[model samples]
Target: MNKHQTIEILLGLLGTLLIVFALGLYILNEPSRLEQAQGDILQAQLNDAMTLYAESCAVCHGLNGEGIGATPPLDSGALRTMPFDDLYKTIARGRFDTAMPAWSKDDGGPLSDYQIEELVALIQSGDWNETGDRVVNLGLAPLIPFTTDPDPVLVEAVGSLPDGATLQTAIGIYAAQCVACHGTDGLGTGIAPALNDPAVREKPADELTRTITYGNAGTLMAGWSNVLSPDDISAMVALIQRWDEVPTGVIPAPDVSIPTTAESIALGAELYSANCARCHGPEGQGRPIAPPINVKSFLSSTTDQALQQIITLGVPGTAMPAWGDRMTDAEIQAIVGFIRQWEATAPEVAQPLGQASGGGGPPWLRNAANATATANAATQPTATPTSASPSVAPSVAPSVAPSVAPYQPGAEAGTGQGGGPPWAQEQAQTSGSAPLDWRVLALAAAGLSVAFTLIASGISSLKKYR
Candidate 1:
């Protein structure tokens, strides 16, 4: 038999075993390689679809599907969560109320059902990282750029509030027409004016009413007169005025209170600085391109209902974009609270001269001043003014005679000839009067609080019933 034969056989067996082990290792790794290949294919398909989305949908949906005004965002949106059938139906049917045109012939647009399906898939299934447990970038989907060109007719139509409309109704109207440019917080963004500024708050009711009704010419502001009735204008003005009166240091709603939540107002402050400070300004002073938000006038004027509606629905025309699909209702509410909190804590600014006058200045100047005041009130001040004056006095006094001076015209041994303009004297008298009738404000606040409570209860009940 022989030792030589035994050794040869053993060597042969070891060689065979080594070859088998190498083959096993290759087999074990093959599935991962295949999976990688499959992922690459999916990513390529997604890239193609995203490219298509950019080319075909970006104009309306936004580059990131954040959606321009009127168009819905597709990124991790309701459409993404909706049943494919419903999604298909919406795309096919098109929303008549908005500019979202039907994509399928069945409804009216140019795309086919298959294309719609593909788009939906690309939006929903596109993973940010292929190798790392397929996590979807929910934030990425709704990152549509905000748009400003809302149809003037649409703005007017939506801004119109029927007589006796509730604050909620008024808010809904603003949401459809103002939130985009103004942001859900009423803090100005891009090319919009803040609705909460002291200057705006101080504007005469009539002037404010006129601005809302007629809108600023040659600007993104669209006249809502065609859509809103005079009564509606009055209601809106009333609302704005109310916001203007909110106390300078009021707190945010309880749910959004920084002390009680996982996310602090401090965090919100950081977020605002990063995401909102540029357009809104560090102190929320309305920039030339934006508006202020921290003034008492703005907070007092806007109701919570209105704030929520604006956050959810957004303004249709103009640069304001809808965030309904981008942020959760809770998140939006938190943001609203954050802005309100800012209004409460932010330093106050004086109203502008023209705004204090009630009516005699250029419309644009008035609008700008008002918008600035409103926007500034909501962004916590990076640098608050050392002294808060009620008004920003004009640099140059008017050339009116001493007799016409608003404060003191002439003084001859207290003959009263030294007193300022009659109107100025009257204003002084009023200013010297007792502080605001807190009892009356309290009563109004109580009444509004009750009304809101009831409404909330009813809504809760309805949800339960459903």
Candidate 2:
């Protein structure tokens, strides 16, 4: 073949090779791409499931599904080994006469079918460890349930019983499982019925045993059968019969002393304005999205630690995100101080929280938007304060705005006041230039090489024909 024809032939072969190479790259990357997409979707699903669990399940089951005293753990091998349908049913319809409420909307619970399915998947995945890490990263406490020795006073009180050892064991169980509702003396709280009542004492041992084993249906009480053995249930029943022997003490007065300072309060105010003022009203009034934290009902009822924990963990199923992830301990404490200040004059009843008005999305989005605005503002010309000189007379502020400040590499961007979370700061620092894909570059180069060759050949062939 002539030079031009030879070139054309080479060009066609080059194009063919390029196509083959690109196809090979696609083949190699396809599985990984598919896997990555699937992983991303699964992660999103897990996050949603975690949120649901924190809101609904975490109180009864420990934060990481480790399970509280009598609550069976979701993170266990038993859950992972469970059949999908059984698991789905357990979460959806719930167990009969158990605390596991029917979560599915069909069963009159809060979650939809899809949400229940997501929870089931979460349980099956056994990813509570990672979920816990995510929660900690957000600055919330893990709230892992721990076993503590029974109160000496409680142990001493029941020591005189014939089965003192059994009663002692039952005290530990009661302290761990039932004391929250039944009180230290079993008088009962607002939520749970009094276990020390004459009516309860009058009930047959079998009836009480059945109630504890099966749980009081349609109530917050969950069956302890899975957690407590037959003997353990018997001990609890025995302890209940001798309830009068256990002395009840007066509940201690609430501690109203919340330590804070002018400086902390001031810092908290700034932080609140930047972070919380949107969802929580500007003046600590309630909003549709957030409750009135400043009102007496909230401030008086919630302890300092409780308030801190709530801020740190966030209220799941609500707009509240775990502030622990975003803020430091000092910052959170400062915010608590700021909120607590209103208690002295706080209204007894919370006024109906008003809906959010004016422009902007949720608080998180507002933070990003505000950050961008702050960055933009920093770039705009500002009145740089003039220093008084010994020799030269200074003008009363420069007539013309000084030329925009020179960009310095590694200089702090935005306000540089270190406002916002550590993550936001890290994001700001990262240039975010993704690594180059050699496979893509190679394909592009090969195509260009072939195209150049073809153009040269065509030009040569046309000249020869002319």
Best TM-score goes to which candidate? 2
Instruction: Name the regions of candidate 2 deviating beyond 4 angstroms.
Output: 136-440, 460-466
Alpha-carbon TM-score of each model against the true structure? 0.27, 0.44
Local distance difference test, each candidate: 0.47, 0.60
Deviating ranges (above 4 Å) for candidate 1: 1-4, 84-98, 102-118, 127-466
Name the top lDDT candidate. Answer: 2
Residues 1-466 of candidate 1: C-alpha lDDT, one tens digit per residue = 4664455455555555554554565577568766766765555556545544533454456545555655666765665577878776766655554445456645435566766766666766854232111111111112112432333343344344443234334555555555544433343332345565555667899898878775664334545666677876776776565553322211111111211132323334544555554555554444445556555655545554345445445444534445444444333444555676756654456244243334435667546756656555544342132111112111101110111111111321112343532323544553342433543454455555556555655665587679
RMSD values for the candidates in order, in angstroms, are 30.0, 20.1
- Candidate 2 lDDT over residue span 1-466, tens digit each: 7865876887788887887888788788878877766765666577678766754566467657887676788888988989989999988877765556667666555678888878888998748866554333332322323233455765776676676888777777876666654543454422345576666777899999998886665444656776688999999998788766654431111223334545456657877877887777666654555555655655665666457646765655678876755555456666887888888987664433332335434776445444433342353222111111101111201110111121121232222464553434544443242323776787788888778877877788789889
Pairing residues by index, what is the TM-score of model 1?
0.27
